[model samples]
Target: MERPVAVKTVAADLLALPDWRRTALARFEREAKAAARLDHANITAVYDAAITEDVCCLVMQLVDGTTLDNVIDCADDGRLSVLAAVSVAAQLSSGLSAAHAAGLVHRDLKPQNIMVDTSGLVKILDFCLVKVLSDTDPQLTITGETLGNVAYASPALLGGEKSLDGRSDLYAVGCLLHHMLTGRPPFHGEGPAELVTQHLTAPPPRLTDCGVDVPAGVQDLAHALLAKRPEDRPGSAADVYEALAPYLPAPAPAFATRRMPPEDPQRPFLVPHGPVMPR
Candidate 1:
């Protein structure tokens, strides 16, 4: 059989695994196809899926740009500029909306999962961890077990919940947004176990505490997205977009200024008498 075209994008190369793992890949391919039916900018494009002698490869679009995680690293003081963060949130919400509409849950959302192309197009990647609502694959629930990225996993997943839906993805988006603006995940500790505990019990440090000027609307959206209980979050991804829309860059043809908002109300109210809020 002919080798697949080489692409520099992550997940471009198929990894060799056991037969059971190959089955998992096949399931992921089917889920990706189901997800592609909902056309959106943030989700990765699935082109083809094939099985080689040793591995199963799912060919996807090669997005050229940096992952959100890397992009945040390049920002001033580690956090993204407010304008840029909002822009990213808007794109992410749109993508999640499409997936939810298609009855799919990303199950894994983090800065590393979001890819921003050189052209400034934001694409959400790695649907290999996606979950389809109606067609619950037996492989997905290995004797009532949940499998997902640990750092971004929802509280319910951590509690050994068997069924996770769109809200789980929203929780992850919240964490991603928090990381984008604060240069750190909302819940972090010495190790993964502590991080999981933080996700379940600890209130995330305020975005402003990170020394960045995030708008109240943006911060509220992040908090809402990061709500501990899935029901406490916005009803859908569209709600998240609506909450974040005001902070996004103004709609211009091109080459428009992307300046930070003057002041973020969600940030602690600056008392003219007290020490000035950190810049």
Candidate 2:
């Protein structure tokens, strides 16, 4: 057992509510199990979880790291440098690829759920909203409401669709990538209801619109990921990694991070930088 694990404690008030506690703890335990079954360096490891009396505790690997949100905030400006943003997204794609393959869909991915360790290793956290695709149980995601953060929720999810797949998670990765490079999420509104409307109706914006001088290819990738329809996005997380490989700030040492098997050597290489544009 790892010492100094990150332990999540449910608030006493929430624990005292029988209905809320039962539903919340059940989802927490199931998602924790799903995350534990995955073996990806970039995905946070779940060590243990238990509900004692009315309290729920989830113990996870203690990462000596900065939250991705903190990293973004610490940037001299409000956003990450282009290469850094792409590199983070690439690593995240690898982690999500493993989870998707394991039949897990991370429904609530956001910058707050990401961490970059002291060694510059990226790990994704919080699987409390995960859905197990292999189960095909309608009850898994049928709460009559959207389940993820409104700002990052996909159009289908905001529409209260009964089923969501890996593509929905990919949409969030797109939003996360855009946020990393722009210091803001792709969509914004005064409230959750307005945000949902924007996601369902607004056109995907370009990096240039946010006044970031990243490569055109970078913006293009974001657009693909943020496509209003799930089918319009990249086929898989591996495909996303391939699209992002050219912009990775640097190579991983000793292949420490996972990579998809060799693909056609003819993959297109996008230019890494472009002329600086005025904000």
Candidate 3:
């Protein structure tokens, strides 16, 4: 096909390291398989993947805007408005619900893997660390290495549970939401080791401590997601979406505001049966 597309190549730094090359290659392939299993509005579409002794790359739909991390970076007070944050959560959970139903776990769901297009539609990116729940293949991860971004990983992930499922991703959603509203992660440490230790032992901080004026229920939802135990978190992404659903913009064209962020996540949910945002 002759068209514009985004190409993901194995990181040059990893490629330069003989010790990391094998694992990086395996992860690149795993990402392709995991992403190919789902077709969702919020998940980035992977068109193709290929690897050999000499090359590795994935062709994906080219995202038109910025990473969620950048969005937070540029926002006032380094945080999104409550409505914008909730909107992002709703779309993200909707995508997660589909991935979970397909028996895949996005082991890495940090904000850096999320894209916010010009219309405010959210697109999940970088499935390099994805886990297929039903697959018996050995996970490409190296033991003793921090899994995913320690900042948003679940206790199960940071502490090395035998198995991880959708709840793990929900934990990341909690972290993302908290970051969106507070401009920082639920926990912090001097390094990966300390961060992992804190994830295993320390409780996630209350959203109120950040002085965010969200509703009581929203605060409770964030806490539920950050619960140290996956079982204590919301049952599934679908459930989380329901909790956040009420905050989505009404799907009425009449509700359009005079001014809104170009990357507003509310745009997708507000249109009257509009086409899905470009993958």
Write candidate 2's Cα lDDT for 41-142 as tens digits: 888888888866755788888987678888888875778877778878887899999999998888888878888865566888988788887666554454
Best by TM-score: 3
Off by over 4 Å in 1: 1-26, 52-55, 143-146, 254-279
Residue-wise C-alpha lDDT for candidate 1, range 152-233, written one tens digit per residue: 7889777777577788888888887877777777887898788888888888667877776776777777787778888998
As a whole number from 0 to 100, the lDDT of residue 274 in candidate 2 is 23
Runs in model 2 deviating more than 4 A are 52-55, 136-145, 252-279
lDDT of 2 at 28: 69
The window of 10 residues in a row where model 2 has the poorest summed lDDT is: 262-271
What TM-score does prediction 2 earn? 0.85
Could you give the C-alpha RMSD of every candidate to the true structure, in order shown? 8.8, 8.0, 2.9
Name the candidate that leads on lDDT. 3
**Between which residue pairs do clashes occur in model 2?**
none
Question: How do the residues 1-279 of candidate 3 rate in per-residue lDDT, one tens digit apiece?
Answer: 788899989878888898888778877887787788789989889898888877798989998889999999999989888888998999899999999999888878888899998877899888777787876665465777666888999899978875899999999999999999999998998998898888899888889987888988899999999998888999999999899877766786654543445676667767634544433
Q: How does each model score on TM-score?
A: 0.80, 0.85, 0.90
Per-residue lDDT of 231 in model 2: 94
Model 3 whole-model lDDT (C-alpha atoms):
0.85
Candidates in order have lDDT scores of 0.69, 0.78, 0.85
Candidate 3 Cα errors over 4 Å, as ranges: 12-23, 255-260, 272-279
